[model samples]
Target: MEQAIVIRSEIRKCMQEEGFTLGGFSKATEIRGSYLSLLLNHDPHKYPLPMRHFDSMIQALGKPEGWLYECYVDECFITGKTDRRRVEPFLLRCAELGKTECIERVLSRLMENLNQLSLVFEIAEKVHAAGNQQGAVPFYECVAEHEKHQHSETLAISQYRLFRAALGQDLHKNRFAATRFAPFRKRLPVEYQLDGLLQLANTYYTLSDWRRLGECADELIALAKVVYQEQHQRKTSKREKTPLNTERHLVLYYGKGYLSKATAYEKQGLYAESKKCIEGYADLSWFEGLDEVGKKEVQMFQIFAVANSYTLEILMGHSYVLSEYTNYLSMHKHEILSGLATILESANKYGFSVDETLEMLSKEILEFKQREDLPGLGWRLRFHYYLSIYFLGKGKIAECIENTLQSLDLSVIINNSGAFAQAVALFELCRGQATDAHLNNYKGLLEEVRKRERFNLGFHNY
Candidate 1:
C-alpha cells in the first residue's frame, strides 16, 4: 500500500478505537464530512493535509498530539522523499510542536549523510530564533556530538553555538556543555577561538560564575596579546604593516578581553583591580575606518567602565574621581542612561540630592516607553530594575514595587534572566514590609520559577 494510504488507514483505525464516527468527528471538529473523508481515505492525488487540521483531528479522534504529523513525516522519510519541498512543512511542524522524539528520529536518519546536517542545523536555528531555546538545545547537542569526531572547524562552531543555546535553556546544562569547549578550542580558527572564548565568558557572566569568567577572560586576554605582538613584530621585521584601519578591530578585541576581566573583578568586589583593567580598556587607541557599529559598541563599554570606576571610587572614599566621571558623562548623549542610573543610585546612597537625577531617569523612562523604535529592551529592563533600587533606598516602597514589577514584566517579555533575577531579588527584599498575601504570592512565584529551572535542567534526581 502507498505510505499515505497506510497513514490514512491508521487515522481511521484511531478514530474507530476512540468510538468516534466519521460524521460525528467531522461535526465536532467543524471539518466537513466530505472534506474529512477525502483526507482520511487518502486519495493519492489529493492535496497534502493542512497543519491546522492535523491537531484538530488528533484531538477529535483522541490521538496523541503530533501523532498524525509524526506518522506522515516517518512515511516521508521511509519513502526517501523527506528532502522534497513538501516535506519541509511537516518537519517544521514537528519542530514547532517540540516533538523531540520525532526530531530525533529524523536526525538519526540524516546522520548517515554528513551533507544533510545543514538541514538539521537550519531547523535548529529556526527553533532557537523562534524563542524556543529549550527545543533547540537538544538538536544542537545532537549535532555537536555527532560532528565532534569530524575534526572540522564546523564542529567547533557547532559546539560553541550549542553551548550558548544550552546556556539560554538552563545554566546547569551549560555547566556540562562548558567542558566540551576545550577540544574545540584548539580545532577552530584563531578568530573563532577568540570569539568563542568571548562567548564563553558571556555565558559565565550569565551564570554569575565569576571564577570561571575570570579564567575565560585570562585566556582571551592572552590570545589578544599574541595577536597584538604578532602585528607589532610584522611592523618591526618589515617597514610595512597591515592597514592601521584593520588594527582597530584588533585593539577592540583586546579591549573586550580587558573589559571582561574588569567586570569579573568588579563582581568579586576587587575594586582596585577592576579599575586598573577598565583603565587598560579605556587607554587603547582608536583608529579611523572602524565601522560605526563597532565604534558604538566599544564606546558603550568604555563609558560603562568609566561609570563603574566612578561608583567604585565613591564606595572606596575616593570621591574626587566623581568630578572626572561626571565631566565625561556630560559630554555623552542620554543613551548613557544605564551608567547614569547607576551613578544616581550611588548618589542617593551617599547623601547627594537625587531629585535632579530622579527627574532625568523618569524623563528617559517615559521617553523610552513612548518610542517604538528602540531596541535593547534588556538594558531598559535593567534600568527599571536599578530604578527600583533607588526608590527602595529613598524609602518609597510603592514606587519601588512599581518599578520592580515593571522590570519583571519587561524581563519576561525579553527573557532576560539577569534582569529577572534582580527583579526577583527585589521582591524578596520587599516581602518583610509587604502584606501576608503579597509575601505568599512572591514565594509561590519564586517556587514556580525554581521548579521550572530544575525541570529544564533535567535534574530528575532532585
Candidate 2:
C-alpha cells in the first residue's frame, strides 16, 4: 500500500500526544512551516510530502520504529493523489444523511478516535430510538462534562441541541440528564464538577423539574456560601461596612442565590417575588468596577433580569420595564445593536419596529464581521440571532429560517452559548413543535439563574 499521504487523525493525535504545535515541530525538525501544515491538514497533492519531512515528523512525534509501515489498509482519498477507489469521506456523507454508507465507511476505516466517533454513533442511535433532544442530552452531557476544552464541550452540546430542537425531537422525551452524566461526573475535579452540576441543575430546571431545581439551587447556594465563608465574611460585602474582600464575597454570593430565586419565581408567575429577588441580586457590589465597560455589561444583564419580569407583563399587556432600559440603551449604547437591540426593538423598548430592527441588525452584522476575528465573538452571534427574529416577525419564515441558520453558524464559531440557545429555541418555536423538550429546556434554563442565587446565600438552607 502506498504510504498514507495524510493520516490526519493520526497526525493530529501524534501532535497532541507530543504536545507540540505545527510551528514548534517545524522549528525543532528543521522542516518548513508550510510543509508541516500540509502534512497536518493532509493535503492530497503538495509534491507527495518530502521524505525528510515525514522522517522528521515521525521522530518529532516519537513514533515507534514501525513509523513507515502500513497504518491504514484503506485510504480515503478526499483529494490529491488519494486512494479514491478505496476510501470515502465519511463525515461529509454522514452529514448528507447517508448513514448506512457512512457507518460502513467508518467501520471500514476504523478511525481510532473512538470516543468522539462513539458519540456520533450514539447520537444517531438515540435520535432513532427516543426520537428527540431529551434522549441525546444524556449522551451529549456525558461527552460535555469530560471535554477538557470548553469550546468543544459547548459545541457538542450545541450540535446535539440544534439537531434535536430543529426537528422537533424534543417531542420524544423529557427528563433530567443528570443520571446519564453521573458515571463520568465524578471523574471531574470537585470545582469542575460543581460548575457542571450547577449547569446540570439548571438544565433540569429548564426541563421544568421545580422540585429538583429547588434541590439544585439549594446545593449551589450551600457550595457558594462555603466558598464564600472560606474566603471572607459576609458582613463586609453586604453591609459595605467591613473588609473589601468581605463586601465582594457577599455581593457575589447574595447575587447568586437571589438571582436563582428571582428566575424561579418569575417562571412560577410570581412577578413581584421574582422582581424582588432580582433586585436583591443586582445590588451594587464591592467588586464590579463601575467603569464604562463594567457598567455596560452589568446594566445589560440587569436589563435582561428585569426584562424577565416584563415578559409576563408584556404577554398580558400588564406592564413594561423596557422603557427606562430603552432610554439607557439608546443613550448609553447606540453602538451595541446585536441581541439586546433586537430584543429591545422586538419589545418596542425604544418604540422601534421589525423594519428598524432589521436595518440596525444589518448594519451591526457587517460592522462586527469587519472587526478582527477573535474569541468571544459576542456581537457576531447577537447580530445573527436578532436578524432571524427580525425576519420571522416580518412574516418571512424562509428568510427567518435563513437568518436562524446563519445565527447558528456564527454562534458556533463564536461559542456564544446564550445566543445559540435563543436561536435554537426560536427555531423550534417556528417549526411548530416547541414540544415537551422545548418546554423542558425553558425549565432547565431557569435553574441556571437560580444556581447563581443559591451560591450567594452562603448556604442553601433557606
Candidate 3:
C-alpha cells in the first residue's frame, strides 16, 4: 500500500513540477484527462493503476524504461489478489527489461496462491516457444518447485523444458539434467515423451554411458511404434484424424530410435547387434505417411546405414575396406570426423599403418579440430585420443604425447570424466618419455581440471 502511494505521489509531484495540468499530462500520455484525474486522486490501496497507463505516464514524463517497476510490482495486485490483466503483461515487460528483481518479487507474491501455477506454466510455454528459453527458466522452476502432484502433466512438461534448456557443452551438467528429467519422461504427453527420450539418449551418448543410451533408445522405439501404429489405424478407419504436434517429423523419432541403438551397440563393441539396428532404419523409406522431410530423413538413415556398415567392418579388423571407407568419407565431408576416428582406432587395433590416409585427410582433421560445437568437440576428443593410440602403436613417442595432451585438454573442457581418466592413465604410462614442454602442458591441464572440480563442488554444496 505504501509503495503504491509513493508511486502515485511521485507521478503527481513530477506533473506539478513540470507545470503540466491533468489535461496536458493526459494529452501527452494519450490517456483521457478524466481517467488521469481518477488515477491521481483515487486511493492507490483501493484502486491501483494499470501497468499500461503507468507505462504511458512514464514515457510522457521522459522517465527511463522500467521507471518505478519495483513499485509497479505492487500495482499488479488489487485488494491482496493478483490482477491477471495487469500481472501478465507486467511480467513480460519486466522480463524484456531484465528486471529480474521485479520478476522475482511478482512471482514470490503470485506463488502465495498456488492456483496461479497454470497461468505461470502457460507463460513459461509461451516464452519457451518464443525462443526465449533462458527467460522461461524461472517460471518453469517456480512451477516445478511448488508443484504438489508428482504425476501432473504440468510438472512433467516443466521438467522436460528445463532439461532441454539446461543442455550445453558441459557433460557433467548434461548428466545432471538427464537424471533429473528421466523420472518424468513417461509422465509427459506422448509427443513430449518421444522428444524427451531422444534427448536423453543423446545426452547419454555424449556421456559415453552406452547402457543408459540403449535403454532410452529402446523406449523411444517402443513409444514411436505405438504412436506410428495408432496414426496408421486412425488413417485406415473412419475416425476423425487428430494430429500429433511433435518437434520433428514423426519418422525422425522412429529412425533415431534405431540409429541411437546402433550407436550404443557400436560403442559397446557389439558389431553384429549394431549392424542389425542400423538395418532397422536402413529402409524406413517404406514407412507410411512420409512427407518431404520424412523422405529426407529416410535417405539420411540409408546413408548412415552404409557408412556405419563400413565402420563396423573396420572395427572388426577388416583392413580391406580402408580405401573404400576413405573414399566414402571424402565424398561426405560431414562424416569425416567420426570416420577418421574409427579408421585410426582400427589402425591401432589391427597394427596397420594409416600414414598415407592421415596425410591425405590432414586438412579435414585440422577443420575438425577447429570446430567448437558440442558434437564436433566430442568427435575431436575421440579423434585425438584414437590418434594418440595410433601414434603410440607406431612407436612415434613425440606424436603420441602431443595427441594425448590435446585429447586430455579437450576431455577436461567437455568434462568427460571417462575420457579424462583414460587420457590421464595413458599419459601416466608414457610420462617417462614426455619432454619438459609436454610435462608443463600436462601440469597446466591438471590445474585446470582441479579448478573446475573445486568450482563444481562449491556450486553443488551451495
Candidate 4:
C-alpha cells in the first residue's frame, strides 16, 4: 500500500511539474480524466491504474519504457490480493520490455497463494500461443516450481512446453531436456503425449541414443494406434470426433513410429528387423479417416518406404543396388544429401566404388557444402566424414584432408560429439600429409571449439 501510494505520488508530482491538469494529461495520453484522477488520488476502493494507461502516461510524459515498473509491482495488488485485471497486462508489458526483475517480483507475490497457478499457466499459454515462447518461460517455470501435485496435468504440460522451447541446435542441451521430460510424457493429455513422444524421439535420434529413441517410438505407435481406432469408430458412429490437436497428421505419427523404429534398428545394424518395420508403412492406403493432409502423409510414407528399402539392401552389403539408388537420387533431389551419405557409408563398408555416383552428384554436393541451414545437418556431417574416408582409402590425401576439415567444422557447429571425435581421429591419422592451409584451418576449428566450450560453461555457471 505504501509503495503504491508513493508511486502514485511520484506520478502526480510529475504531472504537476509538467504543468498538466488531469484533463490535460488525459487529453495528451487519451486516458479518461476520471481514471487519471482516481490514480493520482490513490483511491483504495478502486483497482490499480492499468498497465496500458500507465504506459500511455509514460509515453505522454516522454519517460522511457518500463519507467517505474519496479514500484508499479505494488499496484498490482490490492489489500494483499492480486488484481488479475491489472496484473496480467502488467506482466506482459514487463516481458515486452525485458523487465525480468519486475516479472519476478510480481510472480513471487502471486505464487504466495498457490491458487494463482492457473492464472499464471493461462498467461504462459497466452504468451506461448502469441509466439513469445521465450517470454512464457518464466511463467511456466513458476507454475512448474510451485505446483504441489507431482502428477498434475498442468505440471506435465509446463514441462512439455519447457522441453519444446528449450530445444535448439545444442545436442548436449537437447539430451538433457529429453531426459528431464521423459518421465512426464505419459502423464500429458493424449494430444500432448503424441507430440511430446515424437519430439522426444527426434531429440534422441539426433543424440544418437537409439535405445531411447526406440522406446519413444514404441510409445508413440501404441498411443497413436489406440487414438486412431477411436477416431475411426467415432466417424463410423457419426459421433463428434474427439479432436487430436497433434503437430502433424495422425497417420504421420503412425508412420513415424515404424520409420523411427527402422532407423533405430538400422543404426544398430539389425538390417532384417529394420526391413520389416519399413514394410509397416510401405502402403498405408487402408488407414482410416484420411483427409487430404492424411493422404499426403501416406504418400510421403510410401516414398520413404521405397527409399529406405533400398537403403536397407545397400546396408546389408548388396552393392548391386548402387546404380538404382543413384537413379532414385537423381529423381528426388531433396533426398540427395542423405542418400549420398548412405551410399558413401555402404561404399566404404563394402569396398565398392562410388566415384561415378560422386561425380554425378558433384553439383548437389557442392551446394550442400555451401548451405548451412539444410534440414539434415547431421547427414551433411556424415557425408563429409565418409567422403573423407573414401578419399583417404583411395590415397587422395589432399581431397581427404579437405573433406576431413569440412566434416570437423560441421561437427563443431552441430555439437555432435561422436562425429567430432571421429573427425578429429581421422585428421590426426593423416596429420603428416596435411598442407599448411589444412593445419591452419584445423587450428582455427580447435579455437572455435574452445571458445564454444568456454561460452557454454559460462552460461551454465550464470
For residues 107-190, write the lDDT of model 3, one tens digit per residue. Answer: 999999999989999888877777788888888999999999999999999999999999998887987899999999999999
Kindly report which residue pairs in candidate 3 clash with one another.
none
| Clash tally, candidates in order | 0, 23, 0, 0
- TM-scores for every candidate against the unseen true structure: 0.59, 0.37, 0.92, 0.93
Answer with 2 or 3, whichever has the higher lDDT: 3
* TM-score (C-alpha) between model 3 and the true structure: 0.92
The worst-scoring run of ten residues by lDDT in candidate 2 lies at 453-462
lDDT of 4 by residue, 389-434 (tens): 9999999989999999988888777676677778889999999989
Winner by lDDT between candidate 2 and candidate 1: 1
RMSD of 4: 3.3
lDDT score, candidate 3, position 199: 90
> Over 4 Å off in model 3, which ranges?
12-21, 428-440, 454-462
Best by lDDT: 3
Off by over 4 Å in 4: 1-21, 41-47, 369-375, 454-462
Write candidate 2's Cα lDDT for 1-462 as tens digits.
244543556667878887888889888778888876776674444434443455566677787533532333233432333332333222322323333433444443433443454545445345535554443443343444445554443444433443333321121122323544434443444354455445545454434445566556666567656655644554446645432222222334334555666666655667776667667546443443244644554554466555554454543333244454344444434344433533533443333344543354454445555543332244445455666676666677766666666666554443334455667677776765344554455445445545533222221111
Candidate 3 weakest lDDT stretch, 10 residues: 453-462
Ordered by lDDT, highest first, the candidates read 3, 4, 1, 2
Each prediction's Cα lDDT score?
0.66, 0.48, 0.88, 0.85
